[model samples]
Each structure stands twice: as structure tokens, then as C-alpha cells.
Target chain A: MRDASRAASGRKVCLLTGAAGILGATFCRRWRHEYDICAVYRGGRLQVPTQEEWFIDPLSPHAALRENDNPVFAVKSNLREPAEVQRVVDLALARFGRIDLVVNAAVHVDRDRLTSLASSSDLLDETFAVNATLPIQLAAIVCRQFWQHSRQDNQAWGRNVINLSSMASLGVVAGVGLSAYSASKAALNMLTAHLAAELAPIGVRANVLAPTSFPQLVPTSLVADTVVDLDRSDLTGCIVQLDENGLRETPSAPSALHF
Target chain B: MTMPEPRTLQAVNDLQPLLQARRWRWRATPFPHIVAENVFVPDVQEELARDFRTLYDQRTTAGYNTQHDFLGTSLISTQCGSLEVFISPAWYALFTRLFGINEPGFLTAGVHRHRPGSRNGFPHNDIFPERLDVGPGRGDVLRFGGPVAGKSVRAVAILYYLNNGPWAPGDGGETSLYWDWKDGVDTPVDSVPPRDNTLFAFSCNPHSYHSFRTNRKRRDSVISFVYRGVDDYVQLWGDEGLRQYAEYGRHHA
Candidate 1:
């Protein structure tokens, strides 16, 4: 860690996953001025402005991620492991002293249809683990931390968790082979709703931004602007779709059919 | 003011054979519905479109609440001069001849406007079997309890599109006929584009599920529902009609 004392300097912190991805990098660049960002990347290095200090392994004793005067702190950690996930939260708190926002942008897509059955059980499990389960786990940890920290400080500010989702969650896109991808995204949407309901009393809002299409990919600036819009609004438990037309709130998922 | 013009009368007459030919095909589908183009004379269509636009602008300026959820668009109930055409005897005769009804009781009529980003209406039947007692002076509503409920009566729903301009081919806002509700196989079996001067109609049965796609552009239409019995008045207007009648009672007394 560079300096725990430096982290105490007041600045709203944003913990962004998949910071190396297109959307994630764009968000970091645009939001760096307004927020102290803890950019967590798993695979490659992100080219955003960052502090000189780097923490190789979050689990190790010497692993102390710190944010100096620089607005971004790049922490490389595998989010699949529970220990590593917890470490990212710890690093954010230790570096920035507070996490005001968490953007779960990491997604895994497996293009296998139910009819083909070519996707192995292991692949399906990994897909769900990365796409849905890990995000939920990260959200639970952040919510708990916010609750504990607010109780300690006796002050509550608006906190937010924006889950990057796709329209595949609503239904299977034609010829997209989205059996696993759709199921996982649908699970993420449900998770977002549950989080919104559970965390409302604590001033933490959760929502999903699902884009309708990725033709040439959705503009990163649009996604960033939507995130800022959702963060500033009181809207929660909503799955807003970003398309060429504009943003629209999708209807809630139907209740399960009982036999 | 008077009966429909000769050309408008002829237009109504021309619709009978086309509707008859498709009656069996529409009824055989999961939901019963028919879409007919050129339902009105060109001049009459232009007049209705102009009146609809004027009324829509006036109502929207007066701050009418948008019904984006169930009705699939914003509605304006205030009558306009163009609506007189629907109440004309020629219209009644056309409906009577087309559907083979002895006497058609006009339930209600209204105009609706759907702007962009206002799509995705869940599938639903227009009439239900539930009854609402509207106290004294107001009649009770007897909902359509499907075919099996011997006490139930049928109603006809008609939607006349007035989107009098060119639209993109893939642009949505088409009226969709579905087999069932949201949770069922939601793929629409038939989708009727909101083309100018086109009309879509169906009998309000249990399986007569219909909804509209979100309007990619502006779409305007006039909807009229007709039933065989006066009981449907309560179904169409609901509590608002009762309230109006109560106000009338207060004023007259």
C-alpha cells in the first residue's frame, strides 16, 4: 500500500471490474475526473492513468493496493476465487477509504444452443460462475461493507451497483446460440432486482443496463452516460435497455409456472 | 351531419366480401383477427387523419395521462368532429353486414397516440367475465366469460390506423395478435402494420389476445368497441362512466 493516510483524503471511489475492456476503459477515462477509481483487471493491463504502486497478488500479506495522488489504482486479481474477490473489496477500502460505486462489467459468453448440447457441463458451470455468480458475490460483499461503514460513520450517501447486462436475458436472439449466455444474463437481472429490494433501505441502488444489440458494439460513451444517469436517479429494480433508439425499461420477468 | 357519402358507402360495401373470405382463416388461428387495408375512402381517411392530429395535439397540450402499460398508448376520449363518421348509420350497417349481427350496440370509441419508446404491451383479452355493479341509475357490467360461460356475450374490437406517412420497413408499432399471455409462447402469429387507412378487428374472446409493439415512430389510431348488449358500457368505461353518471345525477337533481 502507498499510504493508508492518503486514502483518507475524501473522494468518492468507483470500483470497476474488467477495466481493460472497451466499455470499462471508456468509463474509467470519462469518470476519473469526478471519482477515485479502483480499476480491477484480470487478464491484460489497462492504459488508464494509474498510481505507480501495483499489487500483484491480493491474497499475499504484502498485497496492499493504495491510491496516491493519482485518481486510478490498477489492481490485478482473479475474480473467480472468493478470496480474491474479497481482497479486491479490501484493497478498494484500504486504498480509497470508501467505495461509492461498483460496476460489474465482466461477462462470459458461450455460444452453444440447447439443441447442439456441445457445451460441456464444465463450460456451463464456468459461464454461470463468471457471468452471474461472481457478480452476485461481489454485490453482496459491497452491500455488506456499505452497511457496516454507514453504521460506523452514522452517515449514509447514495451508493450504486450497475450490472452490465445484455438483451439476451429477455429472450433468445435469433441465431445467436445463446442458451448459456441468455440463462446467465437472466440470472443477473434477477440478482439485480433482489439486490435493489434488499439494499433500498440502506441508500444503495442497484440496476441493470442491457443493450439490445452489439452491432459494431454499443458506443462506450453512451454506456457511460447511462451509468451516470442511473447513478443520479432514484430508479432501482429496473432493467433498462440501451439501443439505437434509446433507453427503455423492460417489464419484470414473469413468475415461474407451478405444476 | 347526414349519412355517409356515396363513395364512403361504396367503400364500406367493398369490405364485406374481403372480410367474409378471411373469416374462417382468422377464426382458425389461435387468436381471431383480420386486417383490412383501404377500409375508408381516400378523402374520408385524410379528413379523419387531420381531425385525429388536431385532437391529439389539443389533448396532449391539456395534459392527458398516458396509458403506456395496458392500453399500449396514450388515449384521448373527448369526441372530435371526425368521430361522427363512426357513429353514422352506414358504419353500423357495414359492421352488421360484415359480422352478421342483428343489432350492434356501440360500447365506446376513443383515439390513441403512441410515440417512440412506448412499445411492448403484454398480451391480454379485451373483455373478462368479472361483473361490476354500478349501484342505482348506473347499469351493471357483465364481462365476456369466454365461450363456455353460457351467460357471456361477445364484443367486437376495431382499430383504425391513421399513421398517414411513410414508415421504415423494420420500424415497429404493429398491432400483434398472440395465442396467449406474456408467459406463453409470445411469438405473434399475425402482425398488422399501422398503415394509413387500414383497419384491424376481432371478436373479444378468451383467446383473442392482442398487443402492440413499442412505437419506433409516432403512430395514431381510433379504436371502437361494439357489443350486442348495453351491459358492455360498464365494461368499457368502468368507474369513470359511473362517476360521470353520478355527477349528472347531482347536476339534474
Candidate 2:
């Protein structure tokens, strides 16, 4: 609703992750014009059909929802793969000229906290993947490809990494079987801070979405709304949330969710 | 470097009459948009899940958050069934024409078997984003969702099935999509009869009223899903998954 065209102009193309998700989907829809969108997501998962069925993007689920007549190639692959990650960056550059904004909208949910001894492996793997490892990997890859490491640590401009971390990364929702899950998110918070400090010098911003949905689940689309604001706000290293008022909200607690 | 596939919008355009009929009710909406569509694909694999009973074993007053409807856990699990009742390539193809593209989907789906004799959910638009970008006079999407009374353009509720049998007329598992009351008038919308492995959708927003009757006779089962266009993708893609997955996020130690 707010006019951000002035701020949006002259920015380099954007590179997005988790494009098929509710948050990712919403982001692509609302912010497609703000930047030349380069959306990504996990590939080849069998999506249960909805009306969304007709628009499957062959590359990734997020890419499947684009409305532009412009050709959006679905680079079918996973973010976990370093080689695959590198390939995605290359694809973006080949399509556009350069990448400006990097939004980490990708997330994997693991819910077996008080899981049985028999299910501990599942719990551990899920926790690690959802909690810490993926974000770390994403940051590493983005830094290698996009960051201008030679810039002053404090005064970098026009570059940022909007990571999709969670409120779980900060506090407790008190759900059953959530010990590992909670611990993992908490670790993500620390990772965000570390990455933010390290990435600051490279003229890149790193922020997280530490939402406080105590008795309920917040939508990924809500998080995407925050990313759309990047064109206007000085929200570098900030984590935004979709609050009760149907608008993007700031974290009640100081530390946001993603790096 | 690798090339990615072009993303396309899956506009649910086969729904002209069904949608148009409802749109006839509103003169204020510039244009109405179908924000969600989930069809039950029949002839697919099926299962019977007892997770709902397990979840509700000791937890009563089942409403969990801001959008609580009834007082009990409303959940269930359905096993494999036919794809005939679920969506087919034909329906999907129709969606393509509406959306102007071909979007691929899969054959696997689960079921929501509400607890036996459970009360229906309180009336609400299924997808509510924490932040809606809609404003006055843009269209119907900005005006949809909530218990009632606010301006909402959402007009249909689509329910698909897990099996190939007809639900008894008295199964009590009807859906309510619209309801209203005032000093001078009162109207309510309700769910159509239950069917096995089939997809039935309708509107219940602003003017298209509807609701689901309680399931008191036989078990109430549904292979639930929803859809939206590229315009409303964020609301669906962003917030819709939490309907089930996020609950798993909140478990006690």
C-alpha cells in the first residue's frame, strides 16, 4: 500500500529462497516488481494438489507461482548442496546481471522434541536441519558469492541477508516434545548474531524473524511481508514478523529470528 | 550455471459460474478473487490415523489460539482411497486455462477426520495473514476472513473426500461458510452433503454464507486443502502450512 518505487529503483536484482512456501509465495506476489526476483525452493517434493496445482514451476515450488510472462527457469535442486547453491547464484547472474538483496526464506520444520529413544535419530536430524545447519550453510554460500569482503566493517551499504529464523530461535512456546527443537532455534539466534557481526564489514545486512506467536503458529507469508519492506526501511539486521493486526511487526524481544 | 523453469500462476478459472454466482451478491468489490482451492484427489492411497483421538485424550476446551472454534480437538486421519474423488488432470487443466499455465501437483494426500461427534469450527476464513496488503476498494481479497461482520471477499469453501462412498444425509458433518443476523434479518450458509472421495466447494464470505453441521451420525472425514492465485499466493503459501505443521512446533516436554 505504501509507495516504495523511489527506494526500489536502481537496486540490483534480488535472490530469494523458499519461494514456494506461504511466506515465499507471498513475497514473490507482493514484491515481484521491487526487484528482478530470483526465487528458490526445495525441489521435487510431491505437492498435494490445490488450485495451485496448475502453476507448478519445474525448477522449484516458489518459482512455480510467478505471474510474469517472463521466462522463470526452475533450477530444480536443493540449498543443502553447496554445488547446487553455487549453481543457483550463477543462474541468477546469467538471468539478470548482478544480485543485490539476498532473502533466506527457506525453512524445514522438525517437531519431535520428547521423541522416543527409537525416534531420537529422526529428532536429532530434524532439529539440526531446521535449527542451525541450513542457515549456517546459506550464510556461508551467500558471503562467498555476493559480499564485498574488502569494505569497511561498519559502513557498508545496499547489501543485506534477510534470514528466516524463528521466535523459537529466541524463547519458548512450551509445546510438547520441543526440547531439541527449542534448543536448535536458540542456537540459530546465536548464529544470526555472529553472522551479522561478521557480515557487517562486507556491506551486507543480516536480519532474522523472531516472531512471538505463543499459543499459535505464524505464517511464513507474514515473514515475507517484512522482506518486502527492505526497499524502504533501514531495517538492516532486523527480524520482522506478521502480527495480530495483519501487518509486519517487530520482535517484542530485542534479538530477531534469522541472520 | 543452471536455468530454472518459469513460475506461473494457477488461477482457479474453471469456477466462473460458482464464483460469479456469489459475486453477484457484492456490488462494492471491484473484482472478486478466489483465494483458496483444495480438491480431494480420489483413487489415491489412504490411511486411518488416530492422532486426533490421541491429541484430545486429555486436552479438552480444544481451541488453541486466536481462531478457536469448538471446545474439543477437531482432528482425524484418513487412509488411502480413490483418486476419482480427488482432483484429476482435467480439473487441473481447467485451472490452467484460468491461470494461463500448467502447474504440476502430486497424488499423495492425508485426511482430517474430526473427532466423532465433534462440533464444527467457528466460522472463519481459513487463511489470515499476519499482515494483509489489501486496502479500501482494491478488491475482495483484502476484505475476506474472520468470524463475520468485517468486509471479506472470500466466497467459497472447498471440501474433498478420502473414499468412494456417499455420506449419509444425517452424518452431521456439514460445512457452514456464511451466517448473519440483525434487528431486521438473519441468514446463514451451511456445507453441502458429504460425499466420498469427491471435491465440493462454495463461498461463505460477505454474501456467500455457509457452515458445517456437527458430525454426530457417522465419522466426519476430509482430505482438506486450499488454494490461491499468484495475487494471493503469500497468504496461502506463507501462512497456510502452519494450519497443521506449526501445531507440531508447540509440544510439551
* DockQ, every prediction: 0.00, 0.02
Task: List candidate 2 stretches off by more than 4 Å.
Answer: A1-8, A43-73, A114-122, A149-157, A213-221, A239-242, A245-259, B1-253
- In terms of lDDT, the poorest run of 10 residues in model 1 chain B is B17-26
DockQ of 2: 0.02
Q: Write the per-residue lDDT of candidate 2 for residues A47-99, one digit (tens) a residue.
A: 22221222332112234343433323344457666577788888877877666
> lDDT by residue for model 1 over A1-259, one digit each (tens)?
0111111235567888988887778888777777788998885446554653222211121233332125478887889866999999999989877787788888787776565556558657878898888887888887677554463231234467889888778876777567788888999999888877777656566788898655455777888878777665556678889888888965344431110
How much does candidate 1 score in TM-score? 0.43
Provide i-RMS per model in Å: 34.6, 16.3
Q: Estimated TM-score per prediction?
A: 0.43, 0.44
lDDT of 1 at B18: 24
> What ranges in model 1 sit over 4 Å off?
A1-10, A52-70, A115-119, A148-156, A214-217, A251-259, B1-253
lDDT of 1 by residue, B1-253 (tens): 2224423533344333222122111233555455566655566677778877777666644333343432222231345665555544445455544455554343445676676667476566665432322234432221122222222233677788885487665777788777655433237755778988777777665567677787677777777655554344344435443343344334323
